[model samples]
Target: MRAVTWALALWLALLGGAAHGAGRGSAAEAQAMVGKAVLYLQQHGRQKALEEFNRPQGQFRDRDLYLAVFDLQGNGLAHLNPRLVGKATGDIRDADGKAIFQAQRALALEKGRGWVDYKWPNPQSGKVEQKSTWLEKSGDLIIMCGIYQ
Candidate 1:
């Protein structure tokens, strides 16, 4: 009985550790994906990176997370959403009337890399929710990937 109880306790502890690790996994993966996209832009150049980013089934896209590249002036250069590509987003705002694109551009230009939060419609839920984007500047453009909160 004692041995059995000890075994059960060990198993539960291992299971708990695994569950905690899984939650951290997704956040780390999102950051890794963004970092890889930045590297791709540096090595392959913007034109090639944009081509890849715009591809429907390209590596820059994965599940609910994908890369969106914009010029410093808020013009959408490459986006996962087909409608947003090639759009002039200088005055684009979030659901709450926050100028999200401008804020993103400012963060990228000032800090060169950081996270910006705003309200957006989640593609998975189709409902507006708090979302955050990790932003980094690559030469004349800003590279970003967002996660819905």
Candidate 2:
């Protein structure tokens, strides 16, 4: 009985640790994505870089993805998603939206990299979606990439 109890506790602890690790790994990946996009834009320029970024990777289409760029003053410059283009994403109001924007701002101001999870509203169904955002600062510009669920 004592052995079984100990085994169960150990298993639970391991599971919890794995879950935490996975979350950390995901945030790291998101940060990397931001860095890659920034580097691409810096090296390739806007049109060519976007073309390459949007190109289908494996099974994903660039149109089905979201990317945005902002100036240091938090004004949007461009967005890969036409719908979001020119919108002020920094003042986003949803709880998750706010969190994501805050993280981006902090990264832009301090680390030059940011990652956060948030909810995106669906256009057709008016439902909120879970999403992750990655941001990186390049000179006076901030580039953002987002993955939605």
Candidate 3:
């Protein structure tokens, strides 16, 4: 019985570590998405970049990691969420009453690129969860991609 318990605990420990590693991998992949998107925006210009970002079946849409672009004024220029596109998000708040878009925009503008953490609805799970988004300033737009944690 003691050996069985020890084995089970070891298995659980390894499982937990694997999960943590997977989470880091997802974040890294999301970061890469943002970097690739910045390059795409820089090379193609806003119109084409927005079109590609909004494309449902395009390279930008990778599972839950999708590209979003918001103008410095906090207006959605390109988003996977159809309801958000062309909407003013300057005052949009998360579940914690944090002005999520404003914070992201400010960080992108202030630092030129960084990550912002906020509560967001995870589409796959349909639940509000902790999310971290990587932001990059592409001219007048703040490009982003997030990972749910």
Candidate 4:
């Protein structure tokens, strides 16, 4: 009975550890996908860039991916989500949205790349969601990508 109890506890602990590790790995992979996508956009320019963003390929489309391009002054230029192409995401003004935008700007200036995890407001649902943002700088433009993990 004592050996059986110990074995059961050990199995449960291993299972829990595996679950936690899996979650962390998934988040890291999502982050990498965002990085790759941003890099691709930086090298390709807008005309050829939209094609990469249009589809949910491999691990990218596994969750919701949002990409936006902005000028240095924080004005949104284009978005992967066609419906929001002309919208002003910077003026979103809400604390979370503003912070994410600011972080993206900072990253572009500092390392030529930036990333942060935050909760974003979903326009359609009006609900807040946990997401990760990746920013890359290419000449005069900044490309920002958000992945809902």
Candidate 5:
């Protein structure tokens, strides 16, 4: 009985830790990541920066928060989804039927940097959840990083 209790406690602690680490990123972190990626892009050029941004475990990727870049025309230059890259993605809608990329593009065009909220399926929870991305316009590129709420 004593050993069983100890094992249960350990399992619960590990589960909590996993949940905490999974969504550790915040809105501020997303903004900062976009800024960092812009700097990296200017320093490294497009091809190299795209490779780094697309890297699953690269510097631009922090847990679920990862960098994605799209052109002003809504063509994905670097995205988590390889299929979206080099294609028009502005028409993609959220579960709620919101034109997410169009909204994001408006923010980039008008404000140059801001947050856009949408809903996405959380793979871990297997349910839809709120997500917000901080995006910045870097010349023709719209760089972004999102935090799961």
Candidate 6:
């Protein structure tokens, strides 16, 4: 009886962990996050918006999905990673050597909003994976959010 109970408990724990890990955000959710961030920027202003976006624990962050913002000059204005906040991310490339930030900049400047796909390390999964980022131009900044595919 003790052995059976222990096995059932372990099974339940494993099942719960799997269910918790399955809640990745969708593409639509990523797009919606971008829009919501834009609205927050408009209402609360840039400084506040950046603070919220850069915060690791906030409404803008969900599972592996979070907001990333860059200045017109390609400097990281807001990101969950503190090290990336003030650095130039435009020169960063993907696993395939694709210019990630340059493509994002071009799309935002030319079309004012669009999707850019690249291979990046998913923070939650700790693996390099395909991702689609939806971005928009908001004043002097470009707001973005992405989903792992």
TM-score of each: 0.81, 0.56, 0.83, 0.57, 0.81, 0.84
Compared with the true structure, all predictions reach lDDT values of 0.74, 0.56, 0.78, 0.56, 0.78, 0.82
lDDT of 4 by residue, 1-149 (tens): 13643353345345542432432223334345557766676687766765555543532343344556777777666654565555555544344545666666777888986555567765434577655555678776776655443
Candidate 6 structure quality by residue, lDDT tens digits, 1-149: 13643353345344543422456766666778999999999999988989899887889998888999999888999887788899988899999999999999998989998778889988877899977788999998999997776
RMSD to the true structure for each prediction, in A, is 10.4, 9.5, 8.8, 10.3, 10.4, 11.4
lDDT of 5 by residue, 68-130 (tens): 899988898887768888899989999999898999999899999877878876545678887
Highest TM-score among the candidates is held by which one? Answer: 6
Q: Give the alpha carbon lDDT tens digit for every residue of 1-149 in model 2.
A: 13643353345344542432432223334445567777778888877765665443511223224456777666666654454455666676664436456567776789876454567763333578655566777877777765443
For model 3 the TM-score comes to: 0.83
Stretches of candidate 1 exceeding 4 Å from the true structure:
1-25
Q: Who wins the lDDT comparison?
A: 6
Candidate 4 TM-score to native = 0.57
> What TM-score quantifies how close candidate 1 is to the native fold?
0.81
Report how far off residue 29 is in candidate 3 (Å): 0.7
How many angstroms is residue 129 displaced in model 3 relative to the true structure, after the best TM-score fit?
Answer: 0.6
- Those runs of model 3 whose alpha carbons end farther than 4 Å from true positions after fitting are 1-25
Error of 3 at 127 (Å): 0.6
- Where is model 1 poorest over a 10-residue stretch in terms of lDDT? 17-26
Off by over 4 Å in 5: 1-22, 123-126
Local distance difference test, candidate 6? 0.82
